[model samples]
Target: MDIPYTSKPRPDTGLYNAKVGIWLFLASEVMLFGALFSSYILLRVGALEENWPHGLLNIPIGTFNTAVLIISSVTVVMAWASLKMKQFGRFKIFQAITVLCALAFLGIKSFEYKDKFTHYEVWKTDGTRMTGHIEGNPMFLTKAKLVAAGKDKIEFLADPHHYSEGKLKIGAQSGEHKHVEIAIGDIKRLSAFVPAHSTYFAIYFTLTALHALHVLGGAIVIGFLFGPGSKMWHTDPDRFTNRVEVAGLFWHFVDLVWIFLFPVLYLL
Candidate 1:
């Protein structure tokens, strides 16, 4: 007796199997980040003041970084399009540009982090003295020249009304607005929102470090897909293109997370 041949076709699943798998994986990732963000909001609300450790961050720098990540997202899309068009050379160029953008982002972030450290803005376990000059408010001078002249005899008293107005107004009648020396020791009240060197700093360092790790991981994936080791996959052009698309999806996700984080952590 002759045995009959048997064959069974796999389900279409509409898109390629790998692409479908990646989407499902990304959905799970969304749930993960959503949970973290929710936790961040809860913790932030329970804090003493909405300002928390710092009133606000440097908005311009944060905005620049935001633009960088947004541009990277666009470049990744262009890379995917290039791959689809079978323009391998163009695909490589776009992929390389995206990676450079990622590095540039990290460079700017480094400068921001360094600024915080150098200014003693970082959190400390044991109370540490912050050494930087506090940007003085200009409106506080009563006799401006006297203060500017550094006359020790001139008395500088905090005007309660002016203080309430959040401006430093000088007594025009007084010979000159006297400049008063403010010492950290003179701070009669500390914002309950300000963490005493430890808690707030820890949160900031931890959050930013984790985000940086994600960027690093994305970089590694892109490196593998476009680097020398890619030769074997390149032999099979279709597989190589699929790999690029998968990496693009991951890179885009990383960029999206940063967009949300930049506003919540820095701007707010």
Candidate 2:
């Protein structure tokens, strides 16, 4: 039997089957992200003010990713609009641009993740926490070494913000940051600012990684619609157009999620 409303809208709903399906799927997605946002808020509010880390994430990089996503959202709409105008070549061009933006966003995100993994945080015996890029593997001053000499410190550049004095205020802040030698015995523990490092990092990794997966999924669907799926444009033009609309809707949702994510994770 032929399925109805693949392209044609149902009389009562005024929407094709594919469009309805997409909306239902999008509703569930809304709930999924809503829960994550709620969790983030609760976590942020409950945490101690001084204990929570801020300004650790790179804002410039986050801003760049936001721009990429915003542009892709526009291009995806244009691609779908091109189909409505029966401009096949224009649709292909816009769709390709959308996919390229996705790649760029993912590339920038990967770089951000790499920086977090390489950055280190050290806690001293006196309860002072120092965070920065490591100079070398933190030396483990064994009990024997600690007793042999009072040299018990891990060497690392103090995180730029840790010392708010005149020194950090005026500086190039590239490969050259304030370096300090901490005795190993004085060091309680040290590790990179990874997911396991703290609650903030754990949640940061979880939320961003999930969003990245969504971007990848959306890119694959868009790429397919731009290439192999375009064949349907010839054989069944209406059905193909409906598919494009549905995919565009999903893409917009993905972009919206990032808009929320950038501020909560990066800016605030």
Quote the RMSD, in angstroms, for model 1.
Answer: 10.9
Instruction: Residues 60-130, candidate 2: write the lDDT tens digits.
Output: 88999999999999999999899999999999999999999999999999988888777877778898876
In angstroms, the error of model 2 at 207 is: 1.0
Model 1 poorest ten-residue lDDT run = 162-171
Off by over 4 Å in 2: 136-154, 163-176
Model 2, position 222, has a per-residue lDDT of 96
User: Candidate 1 clashing pairs?
Assistant: 139-168, 140-168, 141-170, 142-170, 142-171, 142-177, 143-176, 143-177, 144-177, 147-179
lDDT tens digits, residue span 1-268, model 1: 8222111112554455566667899899898778777777777778765234442346688889889889888888888788778787887788788888888888888877765543322112344222232233222122234345664332123322221121122112223332344433333222111223335555666666677887888877787676774684456666666677777888888888888888787755
Off by over 4 Å in 1: 1-10, 121-198
Residue 36, model 2: lDDT of 85
